[model samples]
Target: MIPARTTARTTRTRRGAVVAALLALGLGLSACASDTDTGETETGDESAAASEDETEVSIGIPSGWDEGIAVSHLWTAILEDEGYTVDSQTADVGVIYTGLAGGDFDVTFDVWLPYTHASYLEEYGEEVTDLGHWYDDAKLTIAVNEDSPAQSLEDLAGMADEYGNKLVGIEAGAGLTQITQDEVIPTYGLEGMDYSISSTPAMLAELKGATDAGENVAVTLWRPHWAYDEFPIRDLEDPEGALGDAEEIHVWGTSDFEERYPTLTKLIGAFELDDEQLFSLENMMFNSDEYADEQAAVDAWLEENPTFVDDLKEAAGV
Candidate 1:
């Protein structure tokens, strides 16, 4: 077997190359800060933020995507606190990307790259500025309960009957659902089973029911999800490369956004979040019943992560 360290090293190298190419196209880091010797950019962003422009900002959040919604709200609170009017709306990824390309939406924080959203970016990349990616290790997977009969998609394809002869899915318009319908099912010859296109909530309900009853069920899922912590489920290995590789979650803005909101652009460019921080924020915003209002959820999250805004401000030099 290949050494695990070598495999990890190879994966990271590939990820770095993809990130570099994306930066070359337009990560817009030059608009924010200078590159350091370590290839990481110093994020103070004083190069542009002399005065914060007080303008109305429109942000798009992808429907059924918790991460997008969380970040959209998080940024909304931050930007509004910085004295800007912010409008946040929810829609599908396709609609958001199309609107962004046409200069209708000002910013969106959940564009997945080099894999899940390659088509959208290919069509709209030139029309938009990639503020930068905040999170890496985002991936799509077909998950099953811990006690399921199959350990991988290859195993499931042949034993469809064991998983109720079906595969549960999320929102019909979601990227994960589309990719599973178009690429995954075909690649694995899973056309024999019933593939149900439903909403994320519906899929979660099904998952909860199945797992609680000790039944077998497979559903489309993604990493950095709160469900993994709540449910006793695991991702099925994809040996045929049907599902794409790990993706970086990026923030996208209209091509002229930098000119329109220089300071905001710089601040957005300096954003970064690891899995733990993101998962915690998302859990607070989504899973917690105590904070129904998105802004309130953000406030509660800030209470827990007291230095979040302060650290980001310091990094952005605002």
Candidate 2:
């Protein structure tokens, strides 16, 4: 289970590519959404445009991050309608940022800042341009099903055996996973509990199963996530400040991105989605089976929000 996309649909020339992205296990080039939008997770390495047309844009996002996945495709839909060809890539935060610096990627919508993606920006900040901070309130969390005996990370040490001594996590490289392993576990005396790193989808499936059986389960997660809305879970209190504070997720690109994409940059800079709007998009794209395609899900989401696309466009003066 690949988690929730950031699945990189690589190299299409439609000016509005919504190509099928291959999951983390493969590199054959495809479409997926990444979080770098509260955006943080993803897989694959394909980036850049397939055409010489300046209107063609290449987007990248971190693999397995829902916020990234949702917004990447949302932008794909809008750009497509506006007659701009879009090529989107999904990969790890490291890979995406690397590519962005190398000019392999044009822009990425999910760049969590001041915490989750701090290492990335520290290394690549100068090479990339900040389009804008689209959404604030993105956060990383250690969540348990609402009925669990443990209400906080500290409480887990005593009941580790009751929950099978395991804390399920998303992709190994995910920002959430890293924070859990490096910060949360040690700070909370949770080394006794087994921390497992699997794909986001795997963690989600486990979440579903645990919820279905009414079992106690813990997993890595974040705000602006579809899980909080769809799952019967609550974040464990990070009383010791292991998980860090709320963050602003930004839109990022190559250093020259703003120069080349002024109008689009303005539109992107104007972009922002609150919890309800973002959750709706993620749930539609990742949680629902209603639409068989990424673009279709985005279209449905836009229909409900009604004025989101136009509002961003208008705000950007595009």
Candidate 3:
């Protein structure tokens, strides 16, 4: 079982704890330059020369998700190449939607739709434009050690009795953790199963400890995440399918954005990454120490996949 944090520490320790937790799970951030001054004057000039370049566009993303930052940096780099300035901030999902609805932020590329963030879309559906999916077949999942007898969520049904009636989860309020508490436990008749929905690092620490001891443990897991690459784990089968089928990551832009920056909007709309591409990018940015530099990673990917970059540019009608 994972140790619980006091109420005070819970609030104050989230951000730092999350980063540390990710590192323990083998997801290390690259040693890239701070997002503050990229010093890409030449590319910034080109972005300005592009048709419909905005003076500046602010993008909001959920706090603690490094992948989002990496994606934003890549987009910013590309936009700079085309002459548009990008300003990115880390805010909660609520602020992101509110900012997008009120035109505080021009766009957000981290909307996990049809499941998580459904309520936000319901509220601001009309104020934002849907800009297609970037990543496909991504979903919240439950993963277990490969050697564990629990092959699926079904195997986890009787786990509470065997493993101290405790199920480890990520931070509270996270969509995946909430769903597991509200649905998975009840549907699976795990009424006695007590959930420990702590920060990602706490959960991972417990997971590591359990796996090392060959003890039964189940935790919230997701794709495009570094855990799969770092650990020997298998996704538990979702017999009830509470997790839903493969969902796409959608992009959203403020209503005025399209009219004000058609070229930039088009580029955002055209941005798409297949699983392999995204995995490669994520690995470079989060998994490997040498390749953590965001710009360097983007530059290498652009060199290797010139055709894909050209296609995105052409789709933007550049």
**Would you estimate the TM-scores of all the predictions?**
0.82, 0.83, 0.76
Q: Candidate 3 residues 1-318, lDDT tens each?
A: 112212110001113333343334432211122335664433343244343456477777555454565676666555544334566666656667787888877888877778866777789999998877788777888888787776667778766566667777876646676677777877877667777767676877887788778877777877767677767777889999877777778888888777777656666777888778877777776667775366666656655665655577567554
Clashes of each: 0, 36, 8
Q: What is the descending lDDT order?
A: 1, 2, 3
* Per-residue lDDT of candidate 2, residues 182-291 (tens digit): 89888988888889998888999999999999998988888888888788999988888999999999888889986676667667878888877887888889888999
Better of 1 and 3 by TM-score: 1
Cα lDDT tens digits for candidate 1, 48-119 = 353435377888778778788788877776665544667666777777888788877799999888888888
**Model 2, residue 186: what's the lDDT?**
88
Q: 210, model 3: CA deviation in Å?
A: 4.1
Clashes of 3: 8
User: Candidate 2's error at 310, in angstroms?
Assistant: 2.1
Query: Which ten-residue region of model 3 has the weakest summed lDDT?
Result: 5-14
Summed over model 1, clashes come to: 0
lDDT of each candidate versus the true structure: 0.77, 0.77, 0.66
Ranking 1 against 3 by lDDT, winner: 1
